[model samples]
Target: MSSKVPIFTLSNGVRMPSVGLGTWQMTGDEGKTVIRNAILAGYRHIDTATLYQNEDQIGDALAELFAEGVVKRDDLFITTKAFCHEVAPDVIEEALRNSLKRLRLDYVDLYLAHIPAATRECGSHRTDVKVEDIWKGLEKLYSLGLTKSIGVSNFNESQIERIVKIQKVPIHVSQLELHLYLPQKAHREICKKHSIIITAYATLGSPGRMSVIGADGKPLFESTKNIPNELNDKNVKALAQKYNKTPVQILLRATVDMGIVVIPKTTNPERMKENINLFDFSISKAEVNLLEAHERSKPERLFWWPNVSEHPEDPFAAER
Candidate 1:
C-alpha cells in the first residue's frame, strides 16, 4: 500500500508523500486509534500541529505501530506546526523542542510556522513580530536538527516575499487552505517559482473545519458561515460520476494531479481506504480543467482566528 502512493520532492531534496492524514480536532484515545488506522490504511505521511493538542495521542499511536513492526520511523514522514506564541522568534526553538518531546521523535520531517500571525500566551495578538524574524528561528531549528525542513503557512505574497528576501534556508513547503472553490493559482505560481512544494489543507472544502476550536474555545469555522463545500459542487460531482468514483475521490485526485499535496481528514475506516486508494486511477487534463472551473470568485478561508487582524501579517485580512 505504501508503494502505491507517489512522493513529491521538496526543494531541499526531501521526499514527502503526496497524500497525508490530517489530524485536526482529533484527540484522546479515540484519536490515537483513528491515527493508527490511517497508517494501516497506507498513509506514510501524517500532519499535525501543536495547536491540535493531539500530538501526544499521535505519539502513542505511532509507538504502538512501531512495537508491532508495522512501520519504522524512517518509513514515515511526520509534519507538525507551531502556531500562536510558538511563532515568536525567541520562543520558536523551545516550542518546537516541546513539540518534539510530545511527538516522541528526535526530529520531524517538516516543521511549519503554521501562520504568519503571532499572539501572546493570553490570546492577544502581537503585531511586532516579522515573518523574516520567525524564518530565522525556523532556520535555527533546521541547523540544530530539530526539524528536517522548515516552511510557512497562511502567508500572503508580500509576507512570503519578505521571508524570501532574508531567508538563510529556503522555505521548503507552504500549507494553505486550497480547494476547488479557491484554487489559489497565484499563490501556486509564487510557490512554484521558489520551488516550494504546497501541502494543501481543506482540499475538499473542509466541512470538518467546523469542529476546530479557536484560542477562546469557540469554533473557528463558525465565523465564516458561507464556506463552499466541494462535496456540494456540481462540477466536482459530475466529474466523480464520469470517472465512476466517489465525489470525495474526484476532489482529492484533482488536487493531487496538480502536483499539490493534500491532507484530507476522516475517521471512517472505509473513507480512510478510499482516500489512500487514489493512486489506482488517473484524471485527464481536460477533466482536471473542468474541476478547476469551479474556482470561487474570491478565496474562501475556513479559519479566521480571533483578533487575527491585530497581527501585522494577517494573510486573510483582504479576504475578510
Candidate 2:
C-alpha cells in the first residue's frame, strides 16, 4: 500500500515528518534510550523543549546515531523550543547555542518559542520581554544559518497575525495543544493560510498525568461535560474493537487522518512502540464521525492556566 501520511512543505521548503516523537516529561538517562528507540522505530523527527531539560539526553542519542551512521545530519529533522529566559535576542542566540552544544549539532531543523506569553511571571523561567523581540532574534539566527526554520507555540490568532504583519521572515510551524477534544479547527485554518504548519502536543490528554481541577477543585474530568467519564467511552471502545487497536491508537489515527501532526509523550517503551504502529492502520469515515460526535466543545485543558494568567489574551479563561 502507498504511504497515507501527508507532509506539508513549509514556506522555507523544509519537509517535516507528520508524526514525530515528543519528549516532554521523559528525561534523564532514560530519554536517550527512548529517543534511540524512536529513531530505530522509524521516527525521523524529534521535538524537544528547553524547558523539558532533557536536551542533554537527546544529545547523547544523537551522538550515538551519528557514530553508528544510521542517520546523517541532514536526514533527521530535530525541533527544539526556545522558551523561559531565552526569549530575548542575545539570550535567544545564547540559548540556541547552548541547545546546539547539548545536541552536538551545528544547526536545528526548527526552533520554536515555547509560549506566546509576552512577559515572564512573578517567578518563572521565561523572559519579561515581548514575543516580537524574540521573533526578531529568531529571524537573525535564521539569517546567520544557525537554524533552518523558526516558529512559535501556544500563540493565538491575533498574536500570530501581529507577528505575520511585522515578520521579515515567515514562520514554518506553530506547535500547540491539539487532540480529539481540543480540535483547534480555526487555529489550524489560520496557520494553513499563513503556510505555518502545526505540531500537536497533549494528543492523549495526558491520561497518566492528572487532569486539572475545576472551579470546585474536583478533577476537570469529573465535571467537564465534554470528556467521557472513562477512557472506554462506547464510541472509542467500539472503534477500538473495529480497528483491533486501543482507544489511544484510534484517537491518534483520527488526528493523523485530519491532516495534523501529533506528538504524544510516553516514557514506556511498549507504549512508544505502540504509538508509532499508528502508521499500520486507518479509521473509516463513519467511525471518524462517531468519534467526532464525542468531541467536547470545552475539553478539560490538561495543560493548565495559572502559568497563563500572566497573558492578557487567554481565550479559554473567559469561555471555560
Candidates' lDDT values, in order?
0.87, 0.77
- Output the lDDT of residue 258, model 2: 69
Q: List the residue pairs that clash in candidate 1.
A: none
Which digits, one per residue and each the tens of the lDDT, describe model 1 over residues 77-170? 9999998789988898899999889889999999999889888888788777878888998999999998888999888877888888999899
Cα RMSD (angstroms) for every candidate in the order listed: 1.7, 4.0
The worst-scoring run of ten residues by lDDT in candidate 2 lies at 221-230
Inter-residue clash pairs, candidate 2: 84-126
**Largest lDDT belongs to which candidate?**
1
- Tens digit of lDDT per residue, candidate 2, span 224-252? 33454334678778888987999888888
Weakest lDDT window of 10 consecutive positions for candidate 1: 301-310
